[model samples]
Target: MDINLVLSELQKQNKSVYKNVFNQFYKGMVLYANNFLFDQQTSEDIVQEVFIWLWENAKNIEINTSLKSYLYAMVRNRCLNYLKSIKITDDLNLIDLNSALLLEEDIDNISEDEKAIIYRQILKIVEGFPASMQQIFKLKFVENYKYNEIADELGISVNTVKTQLKRAKLKIGESIPLLLALFLHH
Candidate 1:
């Protein structure tokens, strides 16, 4: 499916095409939102809200960029706005804002090979997490396993799996800027 067609279809009020786009992009967009908020439910809610708004105003909305870029930018802005609404002065949230900026653009300046190396370094950071935490993190994000699936395989509760994943996101999130700096210095 060509994502480029999404804009034209939505403009034409093509419900089927809209559903297809949602199915194709929803999971990835949710993950992208999670990278900012680190709260699964809220991330899902934010993405849902974005999609709802998209459909409700599809005919009126103007998107000059690719649908992927527009969708991600919307999610990123919402996530950052949520963080600000809570309290922007907090130091941890400041770190999150930095991470959001880096992620929202997906580091477009870097080549695919550079991104792979950065991903490897990020994995090294994940390696520093506790054994089970690292395992659960990899299973969820790398393998795209659901919480229940991860819980079942690890013989742990879903809540436990969620907690570990959250911690993993936070830890890895904190290192994003530093890693970007490292990559830039090279």
Candidate 2:
């Protein structure tokens, strides 16, 4: 299939084309994930996550390169992330109940510079979101506004407020794998 046509269909959010593309890529992606993570089930899960991310960002994602290469890259990155997270857990010595219990308190031991870096990345991504969705997200999350409050302020119905917030959350969830890769590495 022509990648441009597939991408166009993706922009339209066509379910059938999306399914076709996912099915075509699934095996290779899983193999790629498995090479690093060495777990078939987790590799399958990671590939599903990659496809979900692709679906969510289809419109914004540039496909100037081959889709196969893109899928390979995503799987490789996710597997590396899985390995790095395992390394972190090992280094923290959280192999026992006692260490697990102390983990919560140790989080506050994060240095100010680390916190600032994470906060800045979060802000950058949020700011990059579409303007209306950004406003809805800020109102819902930062302002802690109820759906009704958001509806009244925007002069939209409560249902509209709810829908917008849901869409905003979906967008964030779709971006999560990528964000996790970046933040976990940092």
What is the per-residue lDDT of model 1 for residues 1-186, given as tens digits with 9 covering 90 to 100?
455477779888899998988998899999998776556777999999999989988877777777888899999999999978755322322222235424544455665666666665565676678889977876776556889999999999999998887787788768776767665556
What are the per-model C-alpha RMSD values against the true structure?
11.9, 15.5
| Candidate 2 stretches greater than 4 Å from native | 88-186
Estimate candidate 1's alpha-carbon lDDT, on a 0 to 1 scale.
0.74
In order, the Cα lDDT scores of the candidates are: 0.74, 0.68
Tens-digit per-residue lDDT, 1-186, candidate 2: 799998999999999999998889899889777655545677999999999999999999887689998888988888878868645222322111123221223334444555455344444455667777777766766556788998888888888877876676565446544534453455
Tell me how far the alpha carbon of residue 74 in candidate 2 is from the true structure, in angstroms, after superposition: 0.7
Runs off by more than 4 Å, candidate 1: 1-4, 88-90, 93-186
**Model 1 weakest lDDT span, ten residues long:** 89-98
* Candidate with the greatest lDDT versus the true structure: 1
Lowest lDDT 10-mer window, candidate 2?
A: 93-102
